[model samples]
Target: MSLFLGTHQNRLDVKGRVSVPASFRSALRKEQTKENHSLIFRPSHKMPCIEVWPLSIFSELTNSLDSLNLFSEEHDDIATTLYAEAWPIDPDREGRILLPDILKEHANLTDSVTFMGLGTIFQIWEPIAAIERCKAARHKVQQKTLAVPPKATKKGVEL
Candidate 1:
């Protein structure tokens, strides 16, 4: 129903290509109004992973950036960094995308890579790296006493 909802593992071929997951491919197809279904692949600013976003999402980001005061230091910094790291990607006929050297180096990806779903965007992670991150996150959550809000009914009463 939505884009990038699950984890998938795929291998990079000798030519540095890896297949996009089938569900992700189908999602991309729906967004297709032109000949090519393209994406922006870049290094994750927060992690050692590749961040993948549709062109439309990047367009929306640019639109939001346009609304920002051009002279603002934060805007200038983000605009510079985002545009510098992103790459426009097109998958081949076989639904494989060629990973660039910089991105691969950043993620430490060799033969195997894991695609992790994040609703609007997805991440390419080394499988072991992904596993370690997941474990660490779970452990961190377990150490915290997070409060859960009570469920609400239509009448706004807690249930």
Candidate 2:
């Protein structure tokens, strides 16, 4: 399994290029030896974060979505919005990718940004927005946990 790891806050230069955190670059390097891996940035419908995925992962995700009924309104809407917004990007020699102005505006990214790794995909978020979003997520998890305590497990295993 290819696990994406790295969470570093970085600044986007005036030209819209941002360094892909050392850890993330190393992970990408390990995944693609010589061939260049393209990065795709698209607006995330479900959140304020910008969706970013490697071209390989992007293809895999799209293929899975392709199995859905394309004629259905829901599927058509999803496909039109997500696919149309995706922008393919290649990191420069300095391991920085130029974020499209539109994507940056959609994600509310300005001077500073937060890069969060999510296994197969990552998200770019404005600093304040990212902090608030994470806090809300943590609170939601806590509420759910309190509502239903974990059951005892065999061999005393717990999660």
Candidate 3:
């Protein structure tokens, strides 16, 4: 799995294009399974930002969704929500992708864009909004101590 870490900020050009951060691009390269790697962008239902999913992770999501009964309301709703406005984007040689107008408007992206790394997935946000979200997230987690259990190695040792 790709491990994306750290936050990056970049300018949004007048042409509606923004460069994906170098670190994020490096992570994406590690996750690539084809000559041309693509990213899936979807408006975040839970936040004012655009959620980016590496194709591999998105495939896993689809596979899990397939477990649901076909055409059932639950399945249909989830599929529609995920696919209806999803945009598959290929970053150019310059590591820039054109930000879709709808996505920009959804996130209220203006002069600058902020990239927030979250392991297998990441998010694009408007700078100010991103800062606000970080504050809120930190505040929420301040009252709790959360940690992921270590994974076991091949020799049955925890890591």
Task: State candidate 3's TM-score.
Answer: 0.90
TM-score of each: 0.84, 0.83, 0.90
Predicted structure 2, TM vs. truth: 0.83
Model 2 shows how many backbone clashes? 0
- What are the clashing pairs of model 1? none
Segments of candidate 3 deviating more than 4 angstroms? 150-159
> Residue 45 CA error for candidate 1 (Å)?
0.6
**What C-alpha lDDT values do all the predictions have?**
0.87, 0.83, 0.89
Off by over 4 Å in 1: 145-159
Instruction: Tell how far residue 115 is off in model 2, in angstroms.
Output: 0.5
lDDT by residue for model 3 over 18-129, one digit each (tens)? 9999999988888787754889999998899999998878887888897899979999999998999899999999999998999999999998999999988999999999
10 residues in a row with least lDDT, candidate 1: 146-155
Q: Between the candidate structures 2 and 3, which one is better when assessed by lDDT?
A: 3
**Mind giving the per-residue lDDT tens digits that candidate 2 earns over 14-107?**
8889998887777777776456478888989888779888887887778867778979997888788779989988888999889888888888
Q: Best candidate per TM-score, number? A: 3
Q: Which model is ahead, 2 or 3, in terms of TM-score?
A: 3
The CA lDDT at 7 in model 2 is 64
In order, what is each prediction's RMSD in angstroms?
Answer: 4.5, 5.1, 2.7
Return whichever of 1 and 3 wins on TM-score: 3
